[model samples]
Target: MSFTLGLIINPFAGLGGSVALKGSDGADTVARALELGAQPRAQLRALTALEALKGLTFRLITWGGDMGELVAREAGFEPEVIGRQQGAVSTAGDTETAAMAMVEAGADLILFAGGDGTARNVCATLGTSCPVLGIPAGVKIHSGVYAITPGAAGEIAAMLIRGELVALDSGEVRDIDEEAFRAGQVRARYYGELLVPSEPRYVQHVKNGAREDEALVLDDIAADFEESMESGVRYIMGSGSTVAAIMDHLGIPNTLLGVDVIEDGELIASDCTARDLLTLTQGCAARIVITPIGGQGHLIGRGNQQLSPELLNRLGRSAFHVVATKTKLKLLAGRPLLIDSGDSAVDQALSGLVAVHTGYRDQVLYRIG
Candidate 1:
């Protein structure tokens, strides 16, 4: 039996993150950015993952542009707008109103864009009864509920709808202190449970670095990270063997499989909860350096939960630094990086070419869907 699929597009998810926009939750900052020529594609960008649903038949409940309904139509799905569109709400209250309408419509799963703020709203409206997915469209998305990319979300949903056996799993729904988030100082706290499918493989678990007796050139990688420490940038280390090497440079031990946060060359927290990581980076304008989980090619939320929805907003989507050896990127051989942002909706938001850093002097463009 298929489920009733609901859709809501913030349409402004990551716009503020790059241009120093504070929030995309219908905030005035988003409006100001739009007035000053901020493009709306970031909102639409989150909708691309739905392209996978090209032939699927499920009832769609959604809001219009700024909500991303037009894009949904383009993806071959016509959705009913449950609320009166006010052009677009420029504040969090508007988002809540939209969510409330979707809930009232008896939508089963609400796939949405933006970071943790969006997640928090889903929690408020649907709680555990309604499962929600984040499309990783905003700057700082830290919760474990977002899909690493949009297509990945679609892939998982496709499997679920096809009756594939994916175990249902429940993960943390988290948020960061907004004021602290803006300053790069963060204090993340958990709100509640996010719906997960039974045996659901649609979402991915957090990833970590590989360790061997000799992790092959591990010292060299650590040395490179040591140099980065000297660069004195606040580093948001993603999961994987490459990032594990950075921990070696910091002289601090790491879990090697979870997200880590460090400031001014020292470890601020390891395997931190999204809330704690956000509090730590609240006011610090440090860059987040992450590597795709080797086989997974995820740059955002797979193994890096600290990039919670709220934190990602503060850091902005542009703050992401995807790192890998050229050899490893070849491992994917041009396959779009898989996303399991914990939320299928967020996964959809990250569906496009993104800039990833492979070395201090190297950056490669890659698709993340």
Candidate 2:
């Protein structure tokens, strides 16, 4: 029998990201994100993975409309439409229903696109009964079920369709309290596990939840950044606790999981969107301060999706300033920093050796890939 691949797309996933809403979990947040002009990219992300399967022979099944059918057709696949979405916008209940339908349809593997919330929904519907793979499309991707990038997820799914000997392992589904996350407090909870293809190179590891106890190290790094601030330059502060230290040093409120703009030692904007940054830094000297995810080592395309490619290209590679503690770099174990900006050319342009601020008056050369 031919392999049957089930597909699901959380259409609203990651919609709140570029708008700096932290996550697209609740209806209110999704509506607010739309009001803020946040564009939906989950369909595009799913299409990226589906396009990689061109000429591959497999039976595809998915939910109707933006959930999966539309993107599947765009990828030239005649997907068997299973269920119709409940309303104008699909809800978490729709996602759960789709998973159940896929399982009942005898799907060999399920491929889903979303963040940790989508992973949780699928896990709740069909635990370890079917092997699944995640295409990263959400803002809060603290879960271990997602691939490092959308294309990587496609490559792994292609492997399974070819009947290759792929190992299936349990990946944890984790979600954070968006309320706490927005308030600069991270509280992640373990929900459940799902059976997933074990491809360490492609699949992302769960984010490190342990708090950084090295307060003195953060102070030193923050001090180094504080010393480097120039007169007319706008600094784009990316998300993460490491970067938050600099904001703390400046006595400014940090968004914790959102982008902020600093200019002349003043908080110009907090929780900025991609469009907001573009407007603020247009025709102005600007620099970006970023830190890689602790366990994933992703410098972009993880949480800081607000750092869109256009802004990065406008600022150029020289405008990027990386900051991380030596311990964080050691955790990568020599893996080059990763970039999945959703633009291949941009990711290529940003790849090279760069100086990383390790501490006060300290730096080291590192590779960004």
Candidate 3:
């Protein structure tokens, strides 16, 4: 028997991609992504994956406009958009309301495109009754509910609908204080539990093993981060212990569990503002030092919305520094590192082995999205 799925797209989710504006939630930044050829990023991944379901018969419920309705239609899901046409823009509050509607409407699985924050919003309302899946959009996805990649979300959901006896799992929904996280601080506290559906065919959840036991196998990659840092090469530490390894070696108190920016052993912007992040980058040239979210393999626009579009552009496509431990990379085995890119097209471009400096003026090609 087939199942029905609810899809919601946080229209403004992860719009910054590799741009420098901190995030894509603001009006100006949304316009900028469109101007810079990113209007389709949010829609394409879900659409293409849905459309690829050649013979599957499943129902979809979604929101109109920049949300999933428009993308679903293009993907041929023909979803029932939530609410009336309210001039084509939706707020975070509206997103929450729409999710409520989908849950009440009896969606078996609620799939959405966004980062950890969006997942939290849905979990707060729906809990575990309707399992939520993420399309890998937003800046930081600390939660365990999101698919490893956008296509993986659709592919897994389809498997479930096709009679795959999936197990139910509990996913983590972490909330980082954006204000505090940007201030070189991590006031991150757990919001609560999230519904994690386990269709072994869909996504797997393990956070690069946060202890010394799993870490022994990853010392080489951690070593790589340290050698690079000592060379005085700027480090844009992403939100994970892999990146934190460098900070540990430096003896600097890093955020440990949040995003922080450091230059020449000094914290320039800690838990900073989008404006402040821009200010921090203006005087000095910076390289975005980031590590993928273990199982997710994401490089940009996750858990760090402060790097809005304008600022992302300042960092540009080439200036990004993606660092991942060999153990984390092994999770994918042979798949190219995936990227939602916040914009589908760029996310597509994000595939393949790109150049990255590992350490000791030695560079290595790491596959990324």
Best model number under lDDT? 2
Q: In terms of TM-score, which candidate is strongest?
A: 2
Question: Once superposed on the true structure, which residue ranges of model 3 sit more than 4 Å away at CA?
Answer: 21-40, 85-88, 200-369
For candidate 3, the lDDT comes to 0.64
lDDT tens digits, residues 1-369, model 3? 447788888876666543333345556767885675543355665675575455788877787777776787777556676663355676667778888898888788888887666777787787777777777776556677877767778777777788777777888776556545435454545667667667544464534434444454345555665555543444556656666776676666776545567877777555444565677677566777666666655565455545555666666657677765455566756555554444445555545677654443445587664
TM-score of each prediction: 0.58, 0.96, 0.65
RMSD (Å) of each candidate, 1 decimal:
10.4, 1.4, 6.6
Our model 3 lands, by Cα RMSD against the true structure, at 6.6
- Report lDDT (CA) for all predictions: 0.62, 0.91, 0.64
Model 2 residue runs over 4 Å out of place are none
Better of 2 and 3 by lDDT: 2
- Against the hidden true structure, what lDDT does model 2 obtain? 0.91
TM-score, cand. 3: 0.65
* Ranking, TM-score, top scorer first: 2, 3, 1
